[model samples]
Target chain A: MSDLTEGPSGRRRGRPPRTESAGTRDRILSAAREEFSERGYEKTSVRGIAKAAGVDSALVHHYFGTKEQVFAAAIEVAFAPALNASEVIEHGPLDGVGERLTRFVLGVWENPTTRTPLLAIVRSAVNNDTAAAVFRRLIASQLLRRITARLDLPDAELRVELAAAQLVGCAMLRYVIKVEPLASEDVERIIARVAPVVQGHLTGP
Target chain B: MSDLTEGPSGRRRGRPPRTESAGTRDRILSAAREEFSERGYEKTSVRGIAKAAGVDSALVHHYFGTKEQVFAAAIEVAFAPALNASEVIEHGPLDGVGERLTRFVLGVWENPTTRTPLLAIVRSAVNNDTAAAVFRRLIASQLLRRITARLDLPDAELRVELAAAQLVGCAMLRYVIKVEPLASEDVERIIARVAPVVQGHLTGP
Candidate 1:
């Protein structure tokens, strides 16, 4: 752990280095996600993110140019993992696609890490036009279109809408809207009941 | 039509009569609905509804008491028509219940009058807990439970939730979230594509 041992590429380091800088950026992003989720977009400030990340406000500003940019980055971080439904549809048997899709989507919301950013997005999308567009693109447009393209059925697009509606509606009721009975029902029970209905949307009789 | 004809019920017309008060109340309710629809709950006020109705703010309070009361009345007014789905389920064949239910619900949305207040409720429900509760009781509890009870299916309650998810999700996309493709697609196309899915929820394999 000497100065000479620190120079792997024979370049002297003045400060932490490139990898450390990237880590700092990630920390800032994580903090931004938390701040935005906890307080929403308008109420959260760059200073708050920096404070949470244990960095100066200027550093947060430098890492993420603006609040909107931070939001886009946070959304990407949140949704990119759950947006893999296209693959399940592309390779899996058509019959089980609904169950697979239902499990994947509900699983995302059930997890705290992913759900936090999504909650922030859904909450803001209620009143903010830009947020709504961001959400629509992330959900209905980006992820859903991929699944629909792979399906072979009459009015496949509309069928996919119906399928999406079932899941999204359940999510709204359970999470955002918080309707009773459905909201309190166990997750496995819900999946068992709803998965088939979603499948009906996919391969109709 | 003058005072000479007052012998009918011993009722003489003075200002505009009792019927005029009822008409004025309807006007205020209509105005409140419009204001709440255009601007969300927090943004709307009794003054705004009164202005929209072309009546004094005092009259709005006199009729509806408070903004909360106005919202409750507006929600009841909006949902009363669409709440007929239970009766359809009660009297009609169990198999065709899906088509009848889907058609009735979508038809209500197609009409501008019903859709306005519904759109307002859905939009507000996204972030506002009060609005969400009101919507839940109206659509999920008041209407769908009756159909669920008659189904005699296992997990009947969950089935109802699943059915509600499909319709509510589609409605959210079409009128509230305004997702593309599905939002712009014709109503009959939606019901045709979705009714089977709803039926599947009710009577699953």
Candidate 2:
């Protein structure tokens, strides 16, 4: 029943083909990222992604099921580095967690390989509600929940959100909108300037 | 020459009709907002806006010139309240500037009438470079520059961007993405929580 819902390509009962390997899956995901980035969520399609990945459309459906599922997978991979950076909160002394987290997350954005997919997913999420829901789910369950767990207060969730807001907004301006000065400014200098405020959100009175 | 460059319809204008009252101009602008909001900047056209306004496409071109110009006019009206709110930084002592600015900006988001167009413009800005350039120009000149002028430091512009980033990020999470806790929380509560961080960005050492 679930496979039926996963779409027609997944309905086969036999063992998967040798061609349906991990590398192929990564190739499809990479292609999906480029498609979503260039065309956005509404305009991108399974067929389009498959064409870009040099594979059959059925292969894409076999792997990622629907476009929403494909987007979620793409987002998960793109966001993995930043998601892992949530550990900075759990590992460090509480005091500098803000700077550590800020530096690590911004570092992911600074690297072109990571930033490309991240930009694609963010652009997709902002422009389409379905994409936003997928993004919200991953961020909440994977990233925000982890950071929230590390905070001891009852209002810790809200606190984590405010801190997230600070970083996310900076990224939106610096990367997505490409607003001047902020867009061109040095990353280290931005981290230095932004870290304290993030710390204040998490641990300040 | 300028009007010719404005687009084809602007070339025929000598004196606009008596029917082209300020009310008609306003109606066209309002319809443009709706079109941009529903279709985003990339998909929205001056003809679509004119159709929505119950006016001829030529009239829309005559009044607003190009699609970009129409978008700018719509944005100016939608953003006027927030632009006016920038005065808050100047009217009071600098100590609570963060809270005032945060409250005003959030208040704009909290109101549905203003938020609709804001969401459209932001979504458009994120999706298309041309729309983004238009948004960046207005925000940098009309909004950021105003806030920058009020600051006493040499890095006042960067400082303002950081502060803006904090609030902008918060707005993105709360309003655009509709992330919970931040999204559904009381506006006053968010203000209390975020003002200090914004304050720190602007004035903290």
The 0-to-1 C-alpha lDDT of every candidate, in the order given, reads 0.74, 0.82
For model 2, the superposed segments whose C-alpha errors exceed 4 Å read A1-20, A51-59, B1-21
Per-prediction RMSD in angstroms?
7.9, 4.6
lDDT, candidate 1, equals 0.74
> How does each model score on TM-score?
0.73, 0.86
Question: Using alpha carbons, what is the TM-score of model 1?
Answer: 0.73
- Candidate 1 chain A: minimum summed lDDT over ten consecutive residues — where? A1-10
The pairs that clash in candidate 2 are: none
- Model 1 per-residue lDDT tens digits across residues A172-192: 888877776788889998898
By TM-score, who's the top model here? Answer: 2
Question: Over 4 Å off in model 1, which ranges?
Answer: A1-70, A87-94, A140-142, A145-159, A203-205, B1-24, B45-66, B145-157, B203-205
Q: What's the lDDT for candidate 2? A: 0.82
